[model samples]
Target: MATRADRRETNPDLGVLAGQLLFAVQRELFGSLAELGFDDLHPRHGAVLAYLEVDGVRATDLSRMSGQHKQVIGTMIDELETLGYVERLPDPADRRAKLVCPTERGRAEMVAADKIMAAMQERHARRLGRDTYAAFKTAFMDVVENQRARDLSRRP
Candidate 1:
């Protein structure tokens, strides 16, 4: 029988592989969060909170960074606000605009998530040797940076 790893090796589509890994990581993250008493949280919420700044950021900026529609990010922000994880405060630069800021609970969750991700990386390093894992991570980041550069170059 062909093992899953063998199958992945045979059909090596980086995008598909990346997506599978992302979903697996998300599952583990969600499970860990639930165990930590954040059962109400949704995986989609990560799109906004994962890259959010400590000070706060405009909703439009979050939408752009997350590559999500403004309305979609708006809905997530609303949900987060209702759950007391985040708050929309008037932007100091523009009173008409709102900045999304993490509440204490949200910051706590982010810390927990960081720990979980670190543990996950440690496990991967163990499985694939420390040196090899480091190289893999560096390569992945190079690819991501190149892609981001290309994307930015296309913008007006």
Candidate 2:
């Protein structure tokens, strides 16, 4: 019988494997957030929340940073605003635009998300061994930087 490790070794799609790991982590983080009374937020909100600045950021910038369409980001922001996680305010710098700022509730959720992710990392470290986990993080970050550079180079 083929072991799980053996099957993973033979899996040709690294992107799929990476996506699977990302989804698993997101699932665990969301579950933890739900326990903390943040069950209203959905996983899709992470795209916006992950790129949100501490002070505030314009919706267009958020859309660019998150690689989400402006309309899609608008919809997510609307949902988040309704849930009291975020609010759209007039942009001082650009009177014609609005900035999406995190509410107090949103900040609290961010902190909770951080704690949950930290716990998840600790568990993964324990399972993978501290040294292996550290190396894995470094490798993943290097890959991210490389991809970002490649993407930049492709820009006009």
Which candidate has the top score in lDDT? 1
Error of 1 at 128 (Å): 1.9
Candidate no. 2 TM-score: 0.81
lDDT of 1 by residue, 49-100 (tens): 8877778999899988887889999999999999988998999999998989
**Candidate 1 all-Cα RMSD:** 3.4
lDDT over C-alpha atoms for residue 21 of model 2: 88
20-42 per-residue lDDT for model 2 (tens digits): 88899889888888889999977
Residue 72 of model 2, lDDT score: 93
Q: lDDT score of model 2?
A: 0.87
TM-score of each: 0.84, 0.81
